[model samples]
Target: MAGGFRRSGQQRQPKLQGKGTLEKMEREGPFKEWLGMPDLYRHTLVIDGDTYTYQVEDAELPFAPGDKVVFRYKEVKSGKWIDRNSLGTWIDPSTYNQ
Candidate 1:
């Protein structure tokens, strides 16, 4: 229910790796909270002017806006809906550049 319809306890694998500037993180909506469900948020990153959204499970990802980061993600498709799900640890910017 975060990015796409993941069956209860279903697992996902990263399809690719991406590096970019983390621009923002925003809660998807209050609808879930209103329904007494868990809160979920999506993170936005910009790479070469292209913006991507990654569904993040962590309430407190270490990276901040304007910080460079590298992450693994997988695209999930359910019907016509597509979403990017963040996987694994977010590589430290200093370590990533070197």
Candidate 2:
């Protein structure tokens, strides 16, 4: 048979659970084994002072390494910390934080 799709029950879908909620952090998180956390929850970013996490799909197009980014931390109703929408801009790293 040519390339075919797996049955509905044969697929393993990932749950998009961010890391802003954790026992070691906020509360005891899901009992996820390894690789359970989505890519969005992988980064533990601490800028200025507060903690922050990235969004999954949005992260695919985000700040790159060595790029000086200007962003603001926004608190969601769920108590999660995230970057303010439309607030991130790329600045010259040479003059950043100076």
| Number of the top lDDT candidate | 1
Alpha-carbon lDDT of model 1: 0.52
lDDT of 2 by residue, 1-98 (tens): 12343665455432222222111112222334457554333344544344555443233435443343444445666543555353354555688889
Clashing pairs in 1: none
Our tally of clashes for model 2 stands at 3
* Candidate 2 segments whose C-alpha is farther than 4 A from its true place: 1-50, 75-80, 92-98
lDDT of 1 by residue, 1-98 (tens): 66654687665453567666666655453224346656666545454355566554545556667776665655545211114343334566678868
Could you list the CA RMSD of all candidates, in the order they appear? 8.1, 12.8
* Model 1 bad stretches (over 4 Å): 1-14, 24-27, 31-37, 57-60, 75-98
